[model samples]
Target: MTTFTIGDVTITKITELEATGDTELMLPDATPQAVRQVTWLHPHYATEDGLLKTSIHAFAVVTPTRRIIVDTGLGNHKMGRPVPAWNGMTGTFLQDLTDAGFPPDGIDTVLCTHLHVDHAGWDTRLVHGQWVPTFPNARHVFARTEFEHAEAAPGHGTAELFADSVTPLVQAGLVDLVPANEQVTPEIQMVPTPGHTPGHVSILIESRGERALITGDFIHHPVQLARPSWTSAGDHDPGRAATTRRVVLEELARTRTLLIGTHFPGPTAGYVIPDGDDTYRLQSLA
Candidate 1:
């Protein structure tokens, strides 16, 4: 388990799945030849043969007054998923979260950066052939725009995702549809960094003059830090996504904010540093 602290706030990673290679499905342009060119990616974000290493996990953010889980990973027993490997997953994500010391009942807030399949899968669990809220005591928060968009035009495996993972929370009256830039807490706020989805937001944590940003899907891998123009295949708007990437990276580099990638593999936290006039690299904090 990897953890980082910003002042009194503690952020711990609870991993559900991790894999290397086959990244081309998400990033078509990230071929082995192209990925090998980003020298900074070697040994951590990328393999020797040039395949990108990625992870699917959630961050347990504990502030002085609240405990929150951000972006729950692919939950177990989800069916009809587009990705064969992601379907019918039987991982010990809930136990893993408990072992990390942030039990489901202890979490008072469940924040989803966006309503994507991988990000919102664990919102509910199958119980006696019925879907139920996993974090029963917590209020599940989602951006209004994202929720509406996904409801109207569900994206890859999102139909099943909504039927099982998301709808249950709404039915139980545990969902909070907030604005894109709502203040989650004094130390944690949503930073509107859309384009991966219409209402996607990156989380910002600030306390005691220290700051960190939990990147949603706006910037997937470290290679995107170097090539901000490269966008994921799942991007809702490629042009806007690329623009957001460039702008976000510039600000991150300028402010020297600790960047915590949502899907980044081990050594996931880093600092964005300028490589040249227009490019940048991630200086891993691990």
Candidate 2:
């Protein structure tokens, strides 16, 4: 139940799905030989098979003028997820949103952190056997570069992510693709944190004097905070991802700003701290 407020805005975490996925391969730099070197950081994640959990977190950004949702996690009816649990299945996502006291119709804007499957899942829903924007009256925001990547349809890693989660939004005319550094509101702005994706951007919340960053996949897990080089196997550009990770970690450490990681353990909100010369750690906040 970790929530934060900035001026008139109130942000709450709305979870859609929670399950462990192939994380063992993510360690030792996703190498075949390093399989045995993997270990779980928490007993809750029983096995080392990546020992990671996927959470579809929706950040309900309640402002005086608008109710925005930053990152809509995997929506229902998504196809072609490597993991069976992520594919064509009905979950309580929309109901959960309403349970949290904010219905889909209440949302004025839906901001995607990036166009990854998990981040863009809830962007659309099944309607009369067709996919449609889950947020009917909302303007779905996306990065122009991100949409292009989907338009190109690269290959395995991100091909389906766009075809399923993003392209449909464009078809519906509800999407608003902006420049990488576009600012949606006075209290919110986008920071160029590409690497995970070509136009990946992290949302910055500057209200009053406090600051917070809604990190999409700039760094997936807390372990990345300890070893910023642990790039995800799904990264479109590993080298660039590493560089972005280092830079973002440094900035988060310097500013002592609160960060919200999409797949972070438990509450998924924390601050970065220096572990050694180049390593850092995630210190969960109150």
Q: In terms of lDDT, which candidate is strongest?
A: 1
Best-matching candidate per TM-score? 1
Q: Each model's C-alpha lDDT?
A: 0.91, 0.76
Regions of model 1 farther than 4 Å from truth: none
Question: Candidate 1 residues 77-173, lDDT tens each?
Answer: 9998888999899999999999889889989999998887899998988899998999999999888998998998876888888999988898899
lDDT tens string, model 2, 155-175?
A: 543577666666687788888
For all predicted structures, in order, the TM-scores are 0.99, 0.88
